[model samples]
Target: MSQAEASQLLGLAGKYRPYPEYKGAGVEWVGDVPEHWRVGRLGSFGYFIAGCGFPHEDQGRQDEIYPFYKVSDTNHVGNEKYLSKADNYVSKDIASKLGARICSAGDYVSQGRGCVAWKQEANSYSGNSDNKCDTHG
Candidate 1:
């Protein structure tokens, strides 16, 4: 598995079409939001976690029980905005040895490092990311 430099992982969100229906957001910065959508500080919902080091030697076993995603996994053909697959996988044993945790089915995984993760939150965690990732719990 190849690792992308943290610097190379920073990305701007692509443009999305306006929601079909809208309602007042009651917030100045965001004038309106899709109907039925809740607007609140993202922190109120979940925490951003730090990525752990995944040694190259423990990567690439398709027989493993978990998928190990690298920043580049974000760019995989089917993962334009969400990770659908990974080039590498790991067993629970290897993940435990690396002090890594797997984000559950709905959790978010990003390429941002600790210092910039919060700032990238708004752009990083939006859709339902079905794929779990190995991170430091």
Candidate 2:
């Protein structure tokens, strides 16, 4: 369809036109969304959790490699670089005290303020550590 035709169908002409038998809260106007679409809060759609911080100096490196991810790692493409080497690992005791949440593949990670972007992918570490998501929860 032509741009003008599409705009007319979408009610972008800037004039208000009422639709048939529509009265709802939180909806300022009709044609803003599809008839079947429903609006809800983010909490209703999914859970929001924050992550925790780990002391940079205390973390150690040893056997058994794992991928460490940070908020900066997520961007337009996703977390392509390893934030930290697996050899530099944290102890289970420290991880537990901090209350870190473990994430698997296909899990979504988002930044709270600075970058304001979300990325989804499988994490390399199956074990737990005090990460960003811990703070949110």
Candidate 3:
């Protein structure tokens, strides 16, 4: 409800509390990080794995093992901060044939392009989506 309330829940979710101290990170996008946190190049932390392009014809199938998530899936009832629901699914054969990537568990799914990114963890990410649940970890 409030900023303070959100911060309190952060602790229960294994989130680290903000450092009492503060300083500019020198990177415009990064803005301010923990006072003691180190600043590095864009890829210094990790790299982004862009997702494939999924045509409309290739989506909306539910007869598969791998889940195909879209950006909208992030708002799913149970997704919250984790992606456990999807509107589409595809079999291994279909995924492989289309050159889709099946991300491993714990991977952070994010938007392919945007000023602010929505990150979420999903069991598996497969196929190209207009919503673009690209993996970054």
The lDDT per prediction is 0.53, 0.40, 0.61
TM-score of 1: 0.53
Kindly list the per-residue Cα lDDT of model 1 for residues 1-137, writing each as its tens digit: 11122224543223334457888778765666679898788666667565567667876677776666666566667666645566677767776787666665445555542111111112233232333332322
Measured on C-alpha atoms, candidate 3 has an lDDT of 0.61
RMSD of 1: 11.8
Which 10-residue window of candidate 2 scores lowest in summed lDDT? 112-121
lDDT of 3 by residue, 1-137 (tens): 43346567765433665569777878665566667877777677777666665657868887667776666676778876667787777677766776677776777666653111122335533333345567766
Which is the winner by TM-score between candidate 1 and candidate 2?
Answer: 1
Write one digit per residue (lDDT tens) for candidate 2, span 1-137.
54346678988755755444433436454324444556666576656556556456644544312333444343325334312223234445544564545444444444442111112234432122322322121
lDDT of 2 at 7: 71
How many residue pairs clash in model 2? Answer: 17
Task: Tell me the lDDT of model 2 at 23.
Answer: 30
TM-score of each: 0.53, 0.45, 0.65
